[model samples]
Target: MTQQPTPDAPTVLLVDDEAALADSLALWLERRYRVRVAYSGREALQTFDESVDLVFLDHNLPGLSGESVLEELSRRVDPSSFAVVMLSAAPGDELADLPVDAVLTKPVTKRDVFDAADRFVGDAPEAKLD
Candidate 1:
């Protein structure tokens, strides 16, 4: 089994309606970060807190869209403190006004995930992609 990083590892929340994808991504991220999974946008908003260092948010969700969740999160926390990476199956041009740190297209590779982590969290190594 892979070892969890140190206690001070950054916490990341994965919000996606696709259970399989979310689960797989969570497993990958857990290697170096504290990962939380929320299947719906409503759950994402409800479960998020100040402790979250980064968020991988899916654009399409059941109750609320990723944009709505980001809007609500922005009101609660300072944008600079945490990063939000919006995930979408299509172009995310409409979400340009949102205070997200980055936008990643769907079917993201492990390298893509790590690249975002490195961009927002820093100190990320170019490890092998799953």
Candidate 2:
């Protein structure tokens, strides 16, 4: 039997400068995870903690880039402790050798994000797009 998450489910951070994408992803994952939104890489770093279970990070931002943010995160936490997925409109070649768990191309649908979330949060509830 699949276990349903309680009020204190694992946290998932959605870091994207695009408001619509971030908001949509948050809504999609909120049922099974506590979703936090960060509009910029700096904001993401400010809100990040050892407790975060996953991160959907956008490659481009006004200030610090997602690659830089990932680098900083690697320094502060163990690579295996949390799952970090880079979302980039550009080719993934630029992010080669980064400590992220995966790299997703931009314009990703809610289903795509949900699928990734499922890998990290086993037995998580299905994400209903409304």
Candidate 3:
């Protein structure tokens, strides 16, 4: 959504029921990555593809819970294809068993976002398709 991304740059799919937070994160991440925003689980599913390198997924949503979304994603794609950072207002115990690369408690800070990005979606250039 941030212009066409540079091919080597990473892509981040940010999913949250909170439009403000989702948009704000997209604005911040756009400087470094191609960012896609989805305010609902259905949209997240529709927007995601193999090109996405990272995901910032919110655990609690109205129509489709993040848990459900994760389940669907696992079923739909290879688990190793992308990194998922699950976000939630709920306690960490609530998310301990989920199949995500990482988990962040919400009211997440800029540090939290970048820390995950730094760890999972670092500076490596994506492999170019011929």
The TM-score values for the models, in the order shown, are: 0.89, 0.85, 0.88
Tens-digit lDDT track of model 2 for 60-121: 87789988888898889996899988898885566877777778888898778878887775
Candidate 2 error regions (>4 Å): 1-5, 125-130
lDDT, residue 58, model 3: 93
The residue pairs that clash in candidate 3, if any, are none
Clashes of each: 0, 0, 0
Q: What local lDDT score does residue 54 receive in model 1, on the 0 to 100 scale?
A: 92
Point to the candidate with the largest lDDT: 3
What overall lDDT goes with each candidate model?
0.85, 0.83, 0.86
The ten-residue window of minimal lDDT in model 1 covers 121-130
Best by TM-score: 1
Q: Which scores better on TM-score, 1 or 2?
A: 1
Q: Over the full model, what C-alpha lDDT does candidate 1 score relative to the true structure?
A: 0.85
Off by over 4 Å in 3: 1-5, 124-130
